[model samples]
Target: MSDKAKIAVDAMGGDHAPQMVIEGLAAARVLYPGVRFVIFGDENVLRPMLASFPELDAASDLVHTDEVVTSDCKPSQALRRSRQSSMGLALQAVKDGEADVAVSAGNTGALMALAKFILRTMPGIERPALVAPVPTLRGESVMLDLGANVECDTRNLVEFAVMGAAYARTVLGLSRPTVALLNVGVEELKGKETLREAADILKQASHIPMEFVGFTEGDAIGAGAVDVVVADGFTGNIALKTAEGTARFMGELLRRAFGSSLLAKIGYLFARRGLRQLREHLDPNNHNGGVFLGLNGLVVKSHGGASAEGFKTAVITAIDMVEADLIRLISADLPDVPGHEEEAGAA
Candidate 1:
C-alpha cells in the first residue's frame, strides 16, 4: 500500500446511495487530503455527482456497477451475485490488494458473509467479529462481536478479546487497553462456562497487549469500566441496541421535559450549552464505523441510514486502520494465545 490510503467504497449500499457516498468522499478528502477513493456504483449516477466535487473527483476512481446488494437480501443470496454487486466489488478491491480497506453502509449480514468468504479469517481466527466504538463516561471504549456470531465458544470469546484489544490500541490509541468480558455479573463464578474459561485464558495470557479486568456487567459498559468489552454476539448486540435506544429515549425525555411548562422552557435556555455538548457526545454519527475484525483485510460497516457526515466518519475510520496497520497488530497478537497454536495446527 502507498502512503496515501485507498478506500474502496460501496457507493450504492446505503439508504442515501451514491449521493451520500459522494458527498462523504468529498468531505473526507478535505479532512484527509492524502486519502484516495475507489468507488463502485452506477456510473450514470456517480459520475454526475462526482463532478460536483472537483477535488474528490480528482482523488477518486469510479467503477461502474449498477448491481447492488439489497438490505433484505440474504447472505446466501448475496454471495451468489457477489462479483457483480457494488458491495461485493468494494470488498473484492481490498482482497485483491487494490485498496487498503473497504467501507459500506450496506446489508450487515451480506457484508459479513462476503467479507469472510472473500478475505477469509486470519490464520488462528475462526470467525470475524463486528467491533465498534461506544461512547462511555470515560470518553470512549470499544466493544466486539456486536452481532456477528450469535453464540460463541470459549476460544471464540478469547479471540474477540485479543482482536478487540488490538482494535482499541490501534484506533483508540490505547497502548495497553483494559479488557473485560460482558456478563450477568462481575464475579468469576457468574455467566456461562465459556465466559469463565475465556477469562481464565486472558488472565494467563500476559503476552497479549491488554490488561484483563475479569468481568463487567452490562450496566457498567457506559460507565467506562473497561476499554474493551468482549461478549458473545447475542449479548453484545442486545447491549449495543439497548444503549442506542436509551440515548434516544433520554434525548426525547429531555425535549419533552423542557417543553412541558414555561418555567421548564426558561430553564432550558440556561442549560442549552451543556445540553448541546451532551447531544454531540451522544451522536451516533461521531461513532459510525463498525469494523469486521479478524479478517485478512479491513472492512468497515457504516449505518444504512447514516448521513454524509456519518459516512465520512466511517471513511476516516478505514484510513485510521490502514495507518495503524490494524491487520498486522491483530495477526501478531493472535499466535501467543493459549489454544491458538493448536487451533491453527488443526486447521
Candidate 2:
C-alpha cells in the first residue's frame, strides 16, 4: 500500500522454481534495496530455498500454497481451478493492493488469461497487449502484441501505438518517441487495411506524445527505424521468434568460423573481447521480461526457462514499470473513445 514497490512472485512457476526464483529475488534486492516481495508457493520447498539467501528472506514474506498452474494447463482450466495457486495468488495480491506488480514465469496463455480475468482491462482499452524491448541497430525499440491477440483491428493497433509509446518513454526514457506500423513496405499504399487505417489514425491523432513515422517494414525493426513498432500478435510473435533464431544462427556461424583453423583460433583470441561484448548485448537474459500492457494492474511475464540472471532482469523490469507509474501514464494518455470518456477519467 505504500509508495515503495512490493513485488508478488509466483515462486512455484518456471523450469527451475524456488531456487532460481530465490536467486533472482536476491539479485533484485541488491539492485533495488527498498523493494519488498510476497512469495507464493509451498512453504516447505520455499523455506529451504529462502534459507540459502538470507538477504532475500529478510526482504520477503512467504505465503504457503501447494496448488500450481502447470506449464501445459489450459488457460480456462487455470482460471477455473487456480484461485489458490501460486501464480493466481500472486496476481490476486496486486488486485488486493498488497503488491505493486506481479511477476511470473508460468504458462504464457494461462498467465494472460488469469491476469486479464483478475486485473481486467483499463478503461477504453479493449484487451491487454504483450510488449517488450527488442535490440536494434540504433539502440532498442519497443514492439507490442508479441503474442497476446493474434488478430487486431485498427483501433487495437492505435491503442497499441499509444501504449507502446508510453512504455518506451517510461522504461527507455524517451520523451517523444517515434511510432510506425509494421508493414510489407514503407509505402502508404502497402500492407493490409488495418495497418493503413492505424497509420492514418496515429498520424492525425493530436493527443498522444509521439511522432507518427508513417510505415516501417519488417526489415526496419532491427534497424531501429522507429521507437515503437505496431503489429498484430501473430506477425509480432513470428518476427520475434525469427529474430531470436537468426541471432542464434549468426552466433553459431561465428563459433564455427573461429573453430575452423589455427589462424581463425588466433583471430578469435584477438577479437574475443569484442565478441564477448556483442554476446552480452544480444543475450536474451538481459531482456527477459514481457509486459502485459493495458491491464488495470501491471503483470510481467518472465521466460519459463530463464536463468537467475534472466529472472533478475524481469524483476528489474517490473520495478521500472512501477517507478514510471505506467498505469497512470497510460490512463492519462489513452485516446478518448466515444461513450468511454467518463470511464476513462475514473480509471
How many clashes show up per model?
0, 0
- Clash pairs, candidate 1, are none
Determine which window of 10 residues in candidate 2 has minimal summed lDDT.
335-344
RMSD of each: 1.4, 1.8
| True-vs-predicted CA distance for residue 280, candidate 2, Å | 0.6
Question: Please, what are the lDDT tens digits per residue for candidate 2 over residues 82-200?
Answer: 98999999999999999999999999999999999999998889889999999888868889989999999988998898899899998779898999888899999999998998887
Candidate 1's TM-score: 0.97
lDDT, candidate 1, at 226: 95
lDDT for position 94 in model 2: 98
Q: How do all models score by TM-score?
A: 0.97, 0.96
Q: Global lDDT of each model?
A: 0.92, 0.90
lDDT for position 6 in model 2: 97
Q: Which candidate leads the pack in TM-score?
A: 1
Q: Write the per-residue lDDT of candidate 1 for residues 152-228, one digit (tens) a residue.
A: 99989999999999999988898999999998998889988999999999998899889999999989999998999
How far is 315's C-alpha from truth in model 2 (Å)?
0.4
